[model samples]
Target chain A: MASHGLTYDGCNFFRQRLLLSTLSGKHVKIKNIRSRDDEPGLRDFEASFIRLLDKVTNGSRIEINQTGTTLFYQPGLLYGGSIEHDCNPQRSVGYYLEALLMLAPFMKTPLKATLRGVTNDPTDPTVDLLKSTSLPLMKKFGIDGEAFELKVVKRGMAPGGGGEVVFTCPVRKTIRPVQLTEPGKIKRIRGVAYSVRVSPQMGNRIVESARSVLNQFLPDIYIYTDHMKGVNSGKSPGFGLTLVAETLNGCFLSAEMSSTPQGQGDPVLPEDLGRNCAKLLLEEVYRGGCVDSSNQSLALLLMTLGQQDVSKVLLGPLSPYTIEFLRHIRDFFQVMFKIEVQKPLEDERKGGDKVLMTCVGVGYSNLSKTIK
Target chain B: HSERESDEEEEQGALKWKEGLQQKAAEAFLRQQAAAPNLRKLVYGSVVEAQESEEEEEELGGLFRVSRPQQSKKVQANTLDCSRFHPDTFHNWDVEEMLDSIRDCFVTGKWEEGHDAA
Candidate 1:
């Protein structure tokens, strides 16, 4: 069987429409083509999209949260997922507001986004069609705008909204000025992999215990034995934060960060932020121990970062402004989570050695500054 | 009013994701109900939120990408808020000893050797 003669036109149509939406100030939201909800109680559904092609999987149960999702398989073992703008507020406010501000002027009326979940997997195509290594999907996301085109900063809206519009969607051209992406660079390092936890199963044996709730999903979910949240603060109402997480198996590992009003947290200088996070995974959620690779199910909470020296790069050379921004993030993470920060080993800048930066911590907890 | 209804729908749309997340989170909590004493999923079950986050300088445009960022940072980024870490109260108590060892390693011009040894 030759090809369907549908590939090019299909991608072109998608690219054109997607680009049009970007110009109009909207974006497509892709889902994991390989994810499935198999927990004893989840609504067992799983359908995703392939970014390079315009296709919909049929019959396979897709885990969709649209209108409190339920399964609806086609005639075969096929699977399919829904497409729409991501409406997560407390989690994705940045993009929504940015859309509102940047595209507000381009629109005489409010803009509506045409969202779709793109799946790039071939072995297990989220949809029935398309090949793996989809460059069209890559091409779509790689088309960059430039400097401000790939950063998250404010311009006071009133006078700077125009500049932001230009930044978010530069020229609407086919080729990207710079890439706009965030890929994890996970590499292994030597360390005794152990599990930690954060929970409050019993009442005053732990009331609002911060220690009990500091749960870490990375490096795997080894619930910490360090129980210390305050009696009435762990699960309060006014907390400004809510921690959500998920592993590659789609097992969401997480916890809330916290601080006693006007107080610093338990300081924990990491042995090495890069190496620490690198050693953060596998299994620990299900058996609450090491993930026996072959014995596990769908993996979630993918954490990728490697051990590297932050000195020669981070503290080395750079334009004052950029370095300042990077340092601010690292320092802030240190104080906020009481963890450690170091330059990332992989994903280093091409021409320079300045790779990515990572923050590492043990366990999870809801440490937001709030009151009930 | 149409836009308002649309907005309401959109909010509802996003809400479903949240609720879905909430539901998954509850299950995740129950599954790993064994989370460490300090870190537990506030919204259990791993939810790979598909959003258009521009954290990568290598990725491309016009769509929402899913990457699990540090949940703490993710929350702050979404809220357009700032996060902080306290050097004064950060972990690691043996600063002087550690620093002395570090200084000694630096002077020997063999920090890696000492690092490997220690």
Candidate 2:
């Protein structure tokens, strides 16, 4: 690492740079963050994210200019323990939890996080979606145990948000390399249609409409209706649907849609929301892969940090965010994936061309974990 | 000698159509290759590092600098940082052909040999 560490411009890909810096033990300096905007600086959500990062690690050094345009972060050791955070309502809890998911496994002790804020929103993946898809994806990397769980204690929508979730994860010495090339035929499709601070019938309506679209493909489709009432429901009135397709090879592909926050845009009917969410799932199925699109970065990150061995994962067309993540991985770990495009056979009815990513792990071990 | 010359001319005309056939095929192949593109290059290559040099400010008279609107590049640099991959709008799920395209992805669809639902 250079004495001055890595330097980046702009606020785009903010979490990726900081997360990689923490893992690689490199200092990072970011400048020109919304410098030209009318209100030029970091937003509340980003500051909350920085504070959360500060809480998880010890002896970390963070500096920001008066306008918050420039930021310097020197990451400290991973000291995992119980912590609480009030995530900014501008973004959902998923925004914060995504970073914790990447960093939790390598901590010195088990991590128990209580996060309060919007649990479901349009901009980011909802906590429900991440719980269904990301947790199972992490299990494939051998980070599974009874303690590995994400629980949603309350349901919250966006805007005037009030929701809570508890996430707990066990530390790991080293991640296991995996070969997840084949995502077998999807046997069943399961989903959750949740409504908070709205009529309980909204949940049922969403479930019905979603199943109507999904029933065309498979007979074993079930969507649960969850209606949280009273204090459990967040401050906003909204509903959403999260669908996951489970394949025979234990691969999961998921998609979700949350209603527009109150006073943000035109209100959405539960029926429309459900039908559209199902269509999103079909889109995900069309981009068939061993891992879903939202979790592609997580899968790739674990592969890069796995024990020094070959890890191969078959993925659908790379998203723009994932393409950027691949470049950042190269800069951080010096690991480049061998990208190969696999064209489907003439008789095969698979959706589209698949990309096979193969790389040798850097043999990253949790140095902070105390020896038993 | 005149008849032999005529025969030679006829032979030359007959073989003229084969001219540049190899070159045409090579050009067509190159076009096809360019259409697909190399995924590795798309991911790791063509990194246009943001230039640090600021654009020269326009001076109005001898008093103040005119503030220019931020460019598209500047806007992109400071956009929201979220990881949700929005679906492409090109796919309309209502079409029957579109539905058939991924029919084999489910267990109800055609199964490959030696792979049973059991």
Candidate 3:
């Protein structure tokens, strides 16, 4: 397995394959990416993502066939530094940033990335949600310093992206093992209702409707109404809400709903979007885990690279992406997690069954980190 | 004497040992094993590793096997990689029963005996 590369089918979970390959120093080959579709082969966005990956690494070998159906990636050293990439507008900046957050801490140098593209979209976790939830989750794993930040320089919606975001992360020689079992009670629910290239009143309408739904649970609810205009607003007219439920123990579970990008889908009223987004937050609360569903794989990756000690985390039902990621982690690192279901007590009104994942880290250290 | 009488008592104790003791222990062990769902097996063992090539080779005019892409497990491996966990059935938020299900997750809800917000 060391001499031969791991081969996968399709372009799904494409980032995970490459990210794992880079961290594990294993070559990966993916074939038949959308080979049967009407417009077969890799999309322009995937090629753009590969280009971004190439920009961040050094001496990486990548090969693709003429139809772009098959790709072979021989990962190179993660030489992270200040870099910028023009993200494909098909997917949001959040899509690219998600992969970057995983690889940033293990880089040779601290990463300061300026990503430009759509900041919010319907298909992926938006930038606001990632900033509010994922960054804090990484902090719990001791990946924090003044350099850790995800600043949204501009707000952009899908289709016609003009957004910009700067993500900076400090490299860690070794990740700290965490035992995040309890989520604690949600103390306050904070949210941002943002609208760009739309009526300023749209932001207000979303806040009022969302407040009406979430005020039933807690009084400490504050939804900030942000209406960006002029050049800061992207080319599309859209409004969305990102709700973060902050627990007493600093666990952030987030839910978001983005309006349909202009001309792509049916336009949604700001009131309806807000009400539905608040309901989504309630649904997330019912799922109820220390790490939100979207960041489960990120948390698990940090745990996998921690010092050689047992790390435990309580997560809601594993997302399909996370489940596939677990299989990949086993293939790359030979680390298998002990999963256990923790059913809520009979009298407890908590939502669903939580799975506790336990794994002893492989004690992977960033050997590339220059020792001063 | 008394020592001989005690020896007789020990002999009777050995003869009247607990019946089905071994069987009882085995049943208890089996029940314990069944109670806790083996999560390790669910994660690793449930992964379908066999790449089943189910497609029958189609030969046109007795030459050249036509290779059509399969919509099998291999195809699904290439599905959308989004992390959203869309539940099959969403809870109707308008219903009071659904709202009551997650009441304890909030600080306003009931706290355990030892823990208090104050």
By TM-score, the best candidate is 2
Q: Looking at candidate 3, what is the lDDT of residue A359?
A: 96
Model 1 DockQ class:
incorrect
Q: lDDT (0-100) at residue A203 of candidate 3? A: 92
How do all the candidates rank in terms of DockQ, highest first? Answer: 2, 3, 1
After TM-score superposition, the amount by which residue B90's alpha carbon in candidate 2 deviates from its true location, in angstroms, is 3.9
> lDDT per residue, candidate 3, A245-311, as tens digits?
9999999999999999888868899999999999999999999999998899999999999999999
Candidate 2 vs candidate 3, TM-score winner: 2
Consecutive 10-residue window with the lowest summed lDDT within model 3 chain A: A1-10
Question: How far out, in Å, is residue A310 in model 1?
Answer: 28
Evaluated with lDDT, which candidate comes out highest? 2
- Writing each residue's lDDT as its tens digit, candidate 2 over A84-123 gives 9999999999999999999999999999999999999999
lDDT per model, in order?
0.22, 0.90, 0.89
Tell me the RMSD of model 1 versus the true structure.
27.9
